[model samples]
Target: MSSHAPRSPFRAGAGAALGAPALAMGVSFLAFGAAVAAAGLGTGWALGASLGVYGMAGQLVLLQAAGTGDPTGATLGATAANARFLPMAMALAPWLGAGPRRRWLALPFIAITPWAAAMRVLPGLPEAARLRWFLGFALVSWLVAGLATWLGLLAAPWLRPPLLAALLFANPLYFALLLAAEGRLPASRLPILAGIAAAPLAVLLPAAWGLLAAGLLGGTLAFLARRPWRRGGG
Candidate 1:
């Protein structure tokens, strides 16, 4: 009865809304709210930063750097840390349409994480429904995160030290949970192993440089390893 095949990527992207992604985001926002409040920032400021930046780790780095009296350096460092976004932009090009006009319009929407992930997986989905699926996932993630941030702001005032500690733990715990969930994916072991190898270097190198170096080195190794395996038995 349908004109097109079913789209697994769309379903997977949408499924995240009901699973780990949503939970991780919600918990992270709660922790971020408590931390920002404890650091003496205004609620409006926290909300504005989250809305504008949309990257939790980047926002935290900037907040810590600026609060310590290096606003300019912090901004520059944050910009550097976010350079991974360039690759993400390239990834979105196909779903956004190949035309220049469409590309320009798609730029703003690129900030949405769900859309970014959907783009990565959309090639495996039904061609006709890919865009719709991407939009659905992006909209839901955006709305939910926005609402959670606002709610967290309202609740921040009452957050005791114990509660704040609990909130802080949520972030790391969620990341661990996400890694566990991703174990089922093909080639997932590569990222897990790379992350393990990079852990010490992550502490030794400066924040921006460490992230960039790890990404480049790990990606290069992964690509080189896969090529030989793909070519023939290696």
Candidate 2:
């Protein structure tokens, strides 16, 4: 580890959290808990989704699919929903340094919130401190999610249709805001803007395919726009 590394990067990471993204994730987990209860699954199932699946979109899909008595399909759907993380993890790979830091223990915690935070700040940090910082941020996020799930399940009986639906919608909406903010980076901005523009078109496609289509189309356009010949034009 470099001497420049903060002795308490993990603590610093912990302190960096409990913020807006955490709040958003909390709200989403609340929705997940409510969904769990509504799906006729119990408290353990809700907590399992939070601690295990960890991804909100995947958690919701897991709940729905699990209810259908098709475990294999449920697993596949949930796995597919969280496939976005593969790229995110890959992007963070270089910052994690070598050996264990590049492996399972730290990588499991790379959720959207912490990943975005890492992109904003990790480049400025000591390489030795980066994983600790991410671990700290991610642990706080994980706890917030778990607590929120408990509360939401407790409140499930009272939350109604429109409200529940609205809560369910909140996570993805906030994720867009995260992406828009990430767009401040010159490399990420064009694709993010393009994705935002293509979002409306996503509605015209099948629910599952829409977002995927929007992302691929948007990212492709952004990549083209940034080509050497089209540099200033982008």
Top candidate when judged by lDDT against the true structure: 2
lDDT of each: 0.65, 0.81
Across 1-234, the per-residue lDDT of candidate 1 in tens digits comes to 575875554464566565665776776777676677767887787776666666776777877887878778988777767666666677676765334553464454455355435645676766655665665566566566666677777787787778767766765676566566566676666766676676666667888667766766776676566666677765
Residue-by-residue lDDT tens digits, candidate 2, 1-234: 897885588888888887787778888899888888888888998999898888876777778788788999888778767776787788887776536635466666777888888888789998878777888888898899899999999999998878988887778788878877887788888888898899886699855456667877887899888888765655
Model 2 scores a TM of 0.84
Candidate 2 has which clashing residue pairs, if any?
Answer: none
Clashing pairs in 1: none
Error of 2 at 206 (Å): 4.5
Ten-residue segment with the worst summed lDDT in candidate 2?
Answer: 96-105
lDDT, candidate 2, equals 0.81
